[model samples]
Target: MKKRRGLSFSQRRAMSGFLFCLPFILGFLLMFLVPMLQSIQYAFSSMQLGLDGIMLRFVGLKNFRTALFADPEYVRTIAESVRDMVLQVPVILVFSLFVSLLLNQKFRGRALARAIFFLPVIVVSGIILEILSTDYLSASIMSGQETIGAFRGVGSYEILVAMGMPQKLIDIMIPVVYDIFNLVWSSGVQILMFLAGLQTVPDSMYECARLEGATAWEAFWKITFPLISPMLLMNVVYSVADYFTTSMNPVIRMINQQTSNMKFEYAAGLSWMYLAVVLVLLGAVYWFMNKRIVYVGE
Candidate 1:
């Protein structure tokens, strides 16, 4: 009898990946799929929570119409969120890449520095973050009476205004700068991803570039940037999703408010609309980035 053929390396790797993801696939189908389908049904109908259970009546997109046309704040909040995301994603990616580069270098207290930077990823749950923002921790770390007064007295925006920057420009930048700390805190995972990507770059590539008389800047653009482009794309997608789902996001808060007010049908419609927007934005970003990604193995 002929011997059975073994799986090829690529096939084996693909099988392993699928095996790892199988549990998640099963869990999503078993636990989430039914509820999600029900939510979609809810979005297209009117739901009343009676003593018996939820009573759903076919409404034929009335909830969607009400959410889009009648609700004053939904569209404006969505617009604001989209604008914030466009501004924030780039800043977060750049900041994460910069910090990851710094962390990748060998130095005294490097482990400590990395731990400090990554602490947010471990501890930044909704309740903990709210407590931190409300309690003395925020006052001590993020702002203080003296610090607030100092910034108001001699703020960067004031300096820019003095230097002949337009009020419109200052207005745009001030909020971004004011929330810089929050941005940095949200970058922990991206920073970790970049650091991991940097570590995967072979030292020999940099050594060869150095031998070829490449400057540090040239070497980075030619070698490091291309190698890490995949991670950059990942960070962008992750940051966008993270920003949308975070507790402080007004869109998420609005959804919660709707649910609390027993407006389930409206909330379901709003959530579906929000999910569509996120999918569209992410699809565009992925298409743009996928074209530029350099697969070193390929």
Candidate 2:
């Protein structure tokens, strides 16, 4: 064979990277990018099942107008969903990190505890979740019928009732505290991520801090928190998205309503709008947290 041309290091790396990303790029374009652009076009069009099946014709921005203004229920549903995600995500992140720290400690039955924590993720989806939330199961096991039946006989409810709370106060307190329970319930992934990050931290750093007369709280603030912050960010984004897409998410209930009502175009518009809102929220989180992320390797 003739002498082969040699590639430079950057050129070789670029080629390898591009080759690795090629499948992802192709999938994104075919599965997401194309479908998204088509959805945007369809959002401005009236869709109906004609003789030839579904037909689309342009109606400009009527869909957006209807969704954003005229469709009262859709707007209200979106607002409620946004509120829920915002409230739940931070709670999940903090709880998950704490759990991760506990799990990472040298203790008995750690593996079993981790498995127990991850059970919800497996159990709380599809048919199993549906069966669990049914009237028979709820009345028998879950105590009260609230969001996901998480707050059946908890102390929060007992305390509210003992305080002689009003009807509305009891109603709100049930779901709010149940949501905190739910947050802790689904924190396994974040815990795993935080555990991994915690593992990567050098023991020498903690040793140095201890030698410098740093207390446990001081070590956490100065060493643990900063070093593992990237994982915290990851967990935050994941928790936010997870909470919004959870089986008990009310926004999903709205989407199911739109589908059942045969408002496909409206549903599509709502989905795209919700996606934009999620992206913006994550972007805000990234922007706010980027400055605080300490590069431990540096």
Candidate 3:
């Protein structure tokens, strides 16, 4: 009999990755797929909980129509959520990258600093974050009359107005700046991801750049940025998903409200519509960023 050839290194690595992902793949199919299909079906039907169990009647596009046209606040809330996402994702990504870079440097208590930064991911649940926002954090940030007066008196708002910026734009920027802490807190996982990516960069590349008399800024653009471009894309996608699904998201809160009110079919329609919008935006981002990502092998 002819001897069988052993698997190559690349093939073995591919198999290992597939094995690692098997559990998640199985869980997604078993747990998420059925409910997702049911929800889609419900979106096209009227659902009622009955003594017999549940009743679903074909309602065609009525639920979609109601969510889109009948509900006054649904579309507006979605629009607001999208606008917040646009403002928040970039800030989160930048903050995460900055923190990751800082943490990657050798320093006293580096591990402790990383743990401190990542503590929010472990301890700050949705309810806890909400409580903190309502009780002490947001109150302190927004209630400082002196700080508010100083900001206003500094001609910051006036400068923007004189620069012909719209009042709506100014309104969005103020709240976003005030909520920067919350945005930074949301970057814990992203910071960790960037740290991992940063560790993957070969030190020799930086040493070579240094030998060439490159400044830290030049080395960063020439070596670090391109090397971490993949991580940037990953963080962008994660941030988008996290922002949309977080409890503070107005769209998600609206959906939860509908579910609480037993408007199951309407909520399903709304969720499906929101999911489509997210997918479209995600696709656009992926398309734009995918072209710019530089692979080390490439």
Candidate 3, residue 234: Cα displacement in angstroms equals 0.8
Q: What's the CA error at residue 103 for candidate 3, in Å?
A: 1.0
Write one digit per residue (lDDT tens) for candidate 3, span 84-191.
889979988989999999999999999999998898897676776567656643544433333355346566778888999998988888667766657667889999
Indicate which candidate wins on TM-score.
1
Off by over 4 Å in 1: 1-8, 126-178
Q: Which stretches of model 2 miss by more than 4 angstroms?
A: 1-38, 124-181
Clashing pairs in 3: none
What lDDT is reached at residue 115 by model 2?
84
Candidate 2 structure quality by residue, lDDT tens digits, 73-152: 87787778788777767777788888888888989999999888777778666888777777453433333255334443
Q: For residues 1-298, could you state the per-residue lDDT of candidate 1 as single tens digits?
A: 9999999999999999999999999999999999999899989998887899989999998988888899999999999999988897888888899999999999999999999999988777677777886664353334423333425455654678689989887667755555766767788999999999999999999999999999999999999999999998898889999888776678988998998999888899999999999899989989998999999889
Off by over 4 Å in 3: 1-5, 124-180
Q: What's the number of clashes in each of the models?
A: 0, 0, 0
Clashing pairs in 2: none
Q: Which of 2 and 3 is the better model by lDDT?
A: 3
State the weakest 10-residue window (summed lDDT) of model 2. Answer: 135-144
- Cα lDDT, all candidates: 0.86, 0.77, 0.86
Considering TM-score, which of the candidate structures 2 and 3 is the better prediction for this target? 3
